[model samples]
Target: MPDRLAPLTEALLAAAQKAGAEAADAMAADGRAVSVDVRGGALEQAERAEGTEIGLRVLIGRRQACVSASDTSARTIAEMAERAVAMAREAPEDPTVGLADPAEVARIWNLSALDLADPAAEPGAAALEDDARRAEAAALAVRGISQCQAASASYSRQRIFLAASNGFAGGYTRTSRSTSAVAIAGEGLGMERDWAAESRTYQSDLPSPEEIGALAGRRAAERLGARKPKTGAWPVVYDERIASGLIGHLLAAINGASVVRGSSWLRDAMGAQVLPKGLSIFENPHRPRISSSRPFDAEGLATAPRDIVRDGVLKSWTLDLGTARKLGLRSTASATRGPSSPPSPSISNIALTQGDRSREQLLETMGTGLLVTAMIGSSVNPTTGDYSRGASGFWVENGQIAHPVNECTLAGNLRDMLMRITPANDARAHLSHVVPSLLVEGLTLAGE
Candidate 1:
């Protein structure tokens, strides 16, 4: 654990005792970040962020109370602890929740796996800004391209420590880096803009700057003269990126927290055939290149590979220690936390199984359909598996791409979408979801 953590944990416990409380815990984290963005081949943004936050929780009898602070002063941490203890004494009692049992809190394992201090993740501010500048300049140089909306480079490093009265103590540190490029193209009467973004836990995994710039330029140029297609039901093709976003939707429904609340659409769908016969989705905390990969979850439990969906049937639920206690089921080491807070249910890496076909082959089979490359917003009701969102992409016709389209809406229920899915032979392990281009047989498209 970070040296800054122990004192506060002791302080919270002492304060809780003074308030006649039974238990207490404290978590604190500090970090720094640098980010830069460019537009029209000019510096649009260059900034750095450094911050620290500490929080304390106290349990009085059956009641619990918590408080947090951005200030790291000795007086502030102690004050936060006192306040939490005081609040716990005044709050209503809840018999169901408290700190993890002493026996159940897993030992904190090696922390080296979480380190991301390499050249890629720790690239200096100048290097990061240069990446953004190079990418943006290339975008503006694209043939027929007018300008760039934005090009950005960013890197961040953070560390956290969590300690509780029940002999639970642990912490880890990691870094993140990302880059993106965007551009506008077309004649005066018909113009369009598009963007490409890439991110990784390690800086070395970032695509070459030239590659990023060229892809952005080509994508924007391709969208020139984009027009809306006829409104009707049509097959939908999910790009590698779009398919990854869909997997995020899957995590929410399969997590134990949502199901316990009776809010997950998968609450009653266990053991049922949810996907195609050969499809499977596994949560792998050990995936080598992902930022989210970890040896254990937020609650300090070992995280191993977990199959949430196997051979088309529902498999297991991602869980935290608290939820596992309530549900009487073993956890899959899916605990996650935001900032330096309590554990929450979350997956590590989402590795979707792929078929043995190329993306090109999948498009050939599509004949005529919409290829969704980017999603603007998330509008999924996890409880009901209902979804509708704004989308932009190109139209596929006669076994080839025909024209670009924009300002369209793709609406469908996830349940039905899964059933109608006609899997493509192409699946790649990129993006957070690690899915392939997906083609669905039926859907409703709304456009002008």
Candidate 2:
């Protein structure tokens, strides 16, 4: 791996400027990954891979163009830079676009939270193959779990850096560990398929192999005794996974870019109740536990805790410096950047505050409501807040979970559901969103 990108970045920046570009930035990244599959207690597939790419962003006054390639030779890099500048010169120019403002770049390089150079993160072929064997063995040990469709483990890392004509320079390395299993349970009428996985930025944060297997096994077992519920309007229960997914959808609505673009349902909803009162959603970029936490945003802006939604009302929109300046709103430090795309708004370590009712009590109170485990799909018009999705889960009847149901549709306008949410206890150890179980009424559940 190349330790110093200064020489390469300067070369590219100079080349772009020579091509009539007013500003330029270059970024490069390299990483490795491993994946595996398991079936019938046997290893199915195994692979290891690594590669790197360099990208160039050039601005001809206001118009900007980006181009990237895997080749790293100086000749190729220079050509890439020149081409990017030429394209920018020909493209439409707009003042709202360019690299992040120079003022926001990170001056101090911080690697305190990351293990950028740990070779152990990238296991050898033999060890990676062994990991798959171990995961499958653990899954098969669980009683009633006859087999698994797949079991896999992976560790990967990325070393990235960016240099721009504005005199800002920065970069960081990140690592990830992921393990997953898909299991089969029962036979025929009672047969069910379920999957579960755990991902962590640090390998040490991942659960033990046995624990991973247990989760996959438990998910499959809990899905047994399936049946279809008589669909009608009743209270709806959203488990942690589904609840987190719903929250994922909400993040985009609060994105500052979307609001400015006039494409978000939240365009005029600020200060208005969006969820049930007492419901709070916090986006804290500096939170230590989350994999998504960042001290500085992708655009190099200092990140701060933001109340995206508070007491059931829209609070602040996610804002990057560019959008913030355009809209006359303060930057919320929500800028997110991928390797190739420019910075955009993203909520970091978002959490919906916990509620008081316990999961058990919330389930018991359902008493003839649909306990939605998985939302089969999300088909929502963010502009209209119209949401309808296929759902599957157990039926709660008279204080107990009865049987699994399928082919049910959960239909409700998000604007309406927001105010109707009845949150429950058990927020800790939920999904990434950390939302508690929730109860909602006044939705149409269509069935016979």
Candidate 3:
């Protein structure tokens, strides 16, 4: 595969130089994917795709432009480079736009330790269809499930290579396998739907189709009689499955782009306490078998584990080469990019510190409050940290779940919410964001 992609990237760089580009970088991706979807116990769709794409970024003085194409023919590569160079020449200059220094480029990496790709032979189309069928059948077999809306199984593999005139050249391959099922219960205006999905880097690590389907069915059934709770200030307990969103907000606020633009709520929060005193958030990009694991970033910078938050204090921002330069700081190697775009800051695997208590224990501590299981829509104010969103869940009374609740709004400021969070010890380690159930105190809930 390198034999094919290497030539395309080399041709792109050579073409850029020929077109009078002061510096250039090229990227190539050779990928294929197969997906199967089943409905009513029958195969509803099956898709297979394979292709190669090349992208070129040419720098003329302080200006840069990016261009990409699915066609890797010699003529197309030359045309793409020429077009990018011409665009760069016309673009306005930005002193922060340039390639990494040769000394800072990653010269070596260990792909084997990352274990990003599965070694097993690709599963056939028939096998994927069978998996989808099994999931649909299992969901339909559930006692209260009225129908299986959809069941899907998919597999994908991608090989990516990057090369630049700044002494950076590297490549890596990644694979993913996934299965999901959506189940429905009740009828007419009372109907509810829920889904469950699991994905893994290795096929062998995926959960059984039946298990996934049953979980989806059970969840849908649980919401059959959901009603709105009373409107008032209450403690809110976010379920483990949906708790990651709260952490994701923090991640976004601290992103280099948001901070640089002065649009993040956390723009002035550096070195201040974000989470509770004992809690922290850290990233591990090299974890074996994790989907986000990478040996090097898109710009060929060596990746490593780092703390986004330490002992509740804001530690660092997620930065790519451009954003780091804009902030007058060194790159954090958090750069990520697609074939058609330049590098930008993005995070990898993140783990939020868990608490000693279990989810059940947290519920008992809450005594009376809302235990949110699902969320929909949002009204977040990035500049002010205010947050409000549609929510559905179960109501707790005297340390016990009384009944399911739905169609309510939860409102609070993210700054206050993070400072009051009490985490539950129930995070799934394999997920890219390993945040557990969280309990926040004194939030306003709008319900009947």
Residue-by-residue lDDT tens digits, candidate 3, 18-49: 98899999999999999999998778999999
Candidate lDDT (C-alpha), each: 0.76, 0.75, 0.93
Once fitted onto the true fold, the runs of candidate 2 whose alpha carbons sit more than 4 angstroms away are 113-121, 188-190, 428-432
lDDT of 2: 0.75
lDDT of 2 by residue, 140-244 (tens): 777777777788877777777677887776666667777888888887667887777887766676777667777788778777767778867888888866777
The numbered model that scores best in TM-score is 3
Q: What's the count of clashing pairs in each model shown?
A: 3, 1, 0
Candidate 1 per-residue C-alpha lDDT over 324-372 given as tens digits, one digit per residue, 9 for 90 to 100: 7667777777876653355678777777777676777778888898998
**Residue 44 lDDT (model 1):** 76
Clashing pairs for model 1 are 120-203, 121-203, 357-425
Those runs of model 1 whose alpha carbons end farther than 4 Å from true positions after fitting are 5-19, 113-115, 119-121, 187-189, 339-342, 425-430
State the TM-score for model 2: 0.92
- Cα lDDT, model 2, residue 71: 81
Q: CA lDDT of 223 in candidate 3? A: 86
TM-score for all predictions?
0.91, 0.92, 0.99
Span of 10 residues, lowest total lDDT, candidate 1: 112-121
Candidate 3 lDDT trough over 10 residues, lowest sum: 1-10
